[model samples]
Structures are given as C-alpha cells and as structure tokens.
Target: MLNPFSIEGEWFKGNLHLHTTGSDGKVTPQEAITSYAAHGYDFLAITDHRQVTEIDGLDHKGMLMIPGIEMDGGQTDLNGSYHMVAMGAKGPMSYDSGWSAQELIDYGNENAEFVFIAHPYWLSLTLADMIDLEGYIGLEVYNTTCHYGVGRGDSGPHWDDLLARGKRLYGFGVDDAHFGYADAWVGYTMVKAEKCEYDDIIAAMKAGNFYASNGPTISNLQCDGNKMLVECSPCWEIRVVCPLPGRGTTTYRSGHKPPFTEVEFEIREGTDPIRIECIDEVGNKAWSNPMWLSE
Candidate 1:
C-alpha cells in the first residue's frame, strides 16, 4: 500500500465536464466559466457538441479552461448506444459512420487523449461492456442536465463494476450544463489534483482521483493500508463504501451535525478501489469515484 500522507498532498478541486453555446447549450463558454469560477471551481472543460472550439486566447482569470468536444457515433439501442467526450487532443477526431464504441476508443487512445462515456444511464447503453476496454478512461456517474428518470440509475454502480473487475476506470459527474430547463451546476466532478494547472488536474481525473457532487463538499479523505479515514460535514450522515474483491460492498455509516466528523473503516487488501459519499442532513448525497491503490 502507498503512504497515506502522500495521497492527501496538494489536491485541487475542479469540474471536468460542462457544456456551452459552442453546442446546444444556451450560455457561452465565457459565461459558463464565470459562473463556475464564482462557485469556487478551479478547473472546467467546455465540451460542446460534435465540434471542438478554438478558444486559444480565452482566459478565465485564475481558473483553467480546458478545450474539449463531445461526439456521437451510430444510434442508441437497448444493449448499446454511443456518445463520447475527448479532451486534450488537437485537430479533428474520427467521426466515422461505421464506428463502434470500441473503435472510437481506439482512435482516442492512439492519439493520446481522454475518453469519457457520457450519460450512460440516460442513454441506456451497456456501459459494462464498453468499460472492458483499457482505453476507455472514464465514465459519468451523474449527469445533472439529463432528465431525472432517463437512464438506468445513478452511475455509481457502473464505476463500482469497473473496479470490481480490477479495472482502474475513472468516474465523472457532469453538469452537462446546457442552461436549459434543468438548472445549471447541479452535478459536478470534483478532482483531487496536484495543482490548478491543466496537466495536473487532467492527470488526477484520468487516474480517478475525484468525487461527484451536487452540493455537498468533502473536506478530507485518507485510506491507509488497512483503515479508510474520511472527514466531512457534521450536519449530515456520511457513508464510506468500497467494493470488495468478491463482488460485495464494505460500508461504514456515521451521523453527526459541525466541527468535523471522522469516519473510518477497515478494508480488505487488493480491494483497493474506494469511494466516499456524503449524505446531507436532508438526504441529498454526493459520491466520489473509486480511488484505486497499488498502481
């Protein structure tokens, strides 16, 4: 197991997925950045439609704005649907008519980019199958912009399954903030990066150093070789859950209400994938993706 202190060092907070006027979104990239900046988000990705914008000189004050694009290939089906997000890549990506989800993932992988399966539950795409590919970097656990009952359930299970299979897949919760009927900033992927820089934040996210949230904020989290240590809002009940290697879940629940609540649990070795979820006093909860250990 890795040292606990190093895991907590210099973790930055950010939102990896969002939409703007470059696509079907109502707000412009600048407007979206402004709103998120005011809300204390350190990084934001403007992933517009099938097109990637060239916001070369655009600046978001101290905040980092990453250029990205969302793509669609083939049609939606009960077993499989296709929509993807590619980040940190230059020039046009392949938009072939005869492309499968795995084909798209291969193209992204060869070009060295980040690939995220968007709104899996909403689209009802067989995410478990797509996750089998090593190139498929991440999955969206919660898409706040989508209709409430559109997809399967929350994406937490999708991420858990990937970890259960011993895959180091990352999880992302996006606002998909189109600024439409749904309220903007409802869901966000909180990244635990080394710094607020572009590469650091992206690297952390690609490595699954993140948690998804609607409103609640997580202050501190630590997982030693044996004990998982977490601290969060005292006003709500907190649940720390980890997917055990044998297809079961290890959970610890604690309730408190101010200064800080410390929760700990002993986890089995080799079942290193862990997630921390904060349930607010009113029952609203936010979840972090599985933080994988052992490289």
Candidate 2:
C-alpha cells in the first residue's frame, strides 16, 4: 500500500495568504498574528500586497511565521486582477503594474520557496488566462474572503481543468484575511512535516505533504493495487476523485443513516492521479493532496 500520510509527523494548521496594515488590511501585523495564534493556528504568512513584511525576532508566542508577499499581475476589465502568493520569500518583491501573470509567476518562482496563484475564481480568470501560466505550485481551491465577500470562492473546477490537461499542481485553501472584511481561522492548510520549523514546513509544502480544508480532517489515506482506503473525521460523505470521465468518482455517503468515519473503495484501473475529499454534514470539506498512482 502506498500511503502519503503514513509518515511520522504532526499536522500543523497554517494559512499561506493573509494581509495586514502593511497593505489594505484593517489590523496591524501584530494584531493579525495575535488573532490567529489565539485561534490555535500553528503557522502563518503575512502576505501583504507587493510587500514582504519581515517578522524576524518578533514574538508570535510560538506560532511559526513564514515571510511572504502577494504580487499583482496586471488586470483586465473582465477578469479583474491577477494575484500570486509567494511564501518564504527572500526579500522585498519588485512590483511592476505592467507585469503579466506569467511574468509575475516566473518572478515568484525564482524568489520564493513556495508560489501559488491566489483566488482565480474571485478574479474571474478564464481557462485561457491560466492554462498558459507556469512556475506556480497551484491555485487556491477556496478563499474565505472571496466566499464571504462575493460568494465566488471555490476554484476546484479551475484546478480540475488544469489537472485534466496533465498539469501537475496542488490545491490550497487560504483565508486571504484583511480582517475588515474577512475573518481569520476560516480556511487553512494542514501540513505534515517532520518538525515545527520554517524550513521543514516549506519542504513539506514543496513535497505536497499537506491538505486544504475549511473543516474536517483526514487521518489516513492509502491505496494498494485496486483498493483504496480513507479514514477521516466523522463526515457525511467521503469521495475518491479521478481525472478521467469514465473513471468517474466513488462516493460513500451516510444519507439518512449514521455518519461514517472511514471508507474503502475499489480503485478502477488506469486512474493515474487520485485525490480524496471528505465532506461534513454542513458541507465543509477536507481535500487531500493528489497522489500519482504510478508512484
């Protein structure tokens, strides 16, 4: 059986995209950190717009902080503006309002340990705009701000479109918290890492050792031959999603019965990259990192 979650490590909750008074946020960086830390967030990146706010030597009470920035990649009347979140950034970002999405993503890839497109659904981006951009780890599957502010948040379809095209990318969930509009502790990533350190978190993120979630938690996931197993926090449904059409999706739901904590399914042949999703009664979901079956 190949199990990505079989490793020995603790799951740390983190938010990769957030803003502070450094940009358009309502609160100061200190307040933002305090609020998230109080809510039990293990790590955070203060990804203010076009600026990497240094948190060196600042006391976060034990919360790990990763340097990050959110860069703008021009805009159009129809698609709004393009945004990218760069984590573990080395220094301040060079902002140019004239840069295209590809150029911004390329620059982020060169300067940061982790880079991902932010809120494509909220930006009203089309497949034509995103299919050609490269050098990013992934796009936000859900952004709390977008969901709360305008009701367009889930970009899972956009992500699936990219995956269907054979583009290997991960999915992320972020708060995109400005505090004034969006609250903290809404959406976050659960990362499995060897240690609770900055470098270890970045390494795990790069290796796709994480899952995105608004609620619920995945405890175990495994695949062997034609069998698949999943154990998660009690949920109404557990689903196995494959990229192909005929491969379809295998879903286990409680319906009017008792909720389930785990499920087992027979994986169809030739399902290359498979992912798991656990949806609770309230519709909150936890998404596992995609696993390439060949690996």
Index of the highest-lDDT prediction = 2
* Model 1 steric clash pairs: 121-151, 211-288, 234-256, 234-257
lDDT of every predicted structure (CA atoms): 0.67, 0.83
Best by TM-score: 2
lDDT digits (tens) for residues 192-288 of candidate 2: 9988798899988887888999888889887777878889998888878777675646453323343768678777788767788888999888888
lDDT of 1 by residue, 1-295 (tens): 2222347546555666667788788888888888888887777777777777666677685788777777777555464557787877566554674677777767766653688888776776664555555577778877776634354436676677666767766667777777876646667776765677877777776666667777677777676667777666663556555666452232322333333366676666665666777777665457766666565
C-alpha TM-score for every candidate: 0.83, 0.94
Q: How accurate is candidate 1 locally (lDDT)?
A: 0.67
**Off by more than 4 A, model 2:** 1-3, 75-79, 252-258
Worst 10 residues of 2 by lDDT: 249-258
Clash totals in order: 4, 0
